[model samples]
Target: MTKLFCILDGHSTPFSVVVSPDDTVDDLKKAIKKEKEPEFDYIPADKLNLWHVSIVIGDDEDEKTITLSEHPDAKKLHATSEISEVFGSAPAKKTIHVIVQRPSQGSSAGTSSQVNSK
Candidate 1:
């Protein structure tokens, strides 16, 4: 098994998981859902949509776009020249990054202070 660094939606918080070289991109998506979703037990892996997410391998700036419907083959799903040509170079290992934003409360003061100061 190989350890891969995953960045959830460009989020500063990253997760590390050990996966087989044969693991497909879809497999990774499942792992993400399991970790992030509050109701993962009710949700199915295939039901989740990740077509818009960008996948970055290692330190490479190039982002690979793949969906569950496409790139079923993990081995074939590597960062090919075709993808590299369009996106950029591929990293030696795979790395995924995710970004998320927290909802902001009204007022310039922090939530704790705003509620307490009032």
Candidate 2:
């Protein structure tokens, strides 16, 4: 499983979710909704689009956005993009986990470091 301490709050929400290597960004969004957990009800995955996704590797949160859908699936997107490749297989059980935060403005440009332990 591809573990990530997802900073699922970009639009005034905060939460985490587990995903697999074969899962697409779209699926990731759907998951936030499909899980049916009220805790993350604010993250409505039904409308998760490419623009809603942001990725950061290691200590970088550059607010970069990629066309994940263009690659067909998450695997392909991971292979083609450096950001996806790095975080695609981050180690688990680390005391200092990563906070993969989505852009807060539906479009953001800050990479400020944030703590996301899992």
Candidate 2 lDDT, 21-113, residue by residue in tens = 666665656565555456435554534333323343343433433333432333212222333444546544321122233335453333334
In model 2, pairs of residues that clash are: 9-13, 61-111
Worst 10 residues of 2 by lDDT: 71-80
- 3-94: candidate 1 lDDT, tens digit per residue: 44544333344556554555555565566556766734444544443322245444544454323334333222222113222223432345
lDDT for every model?
0.41, 0.42
Cα error, candidate 2, residue 9 (Å)? 3.5
Query: Model 2 compared with the native: what TM-score?
Result: 0.37
Superposed model 2: Cα runs more than 4 Å off: 8-14, 39-44, 49-86, 91-118
TM-scores for all candidates: the values are 0.36, 0.37
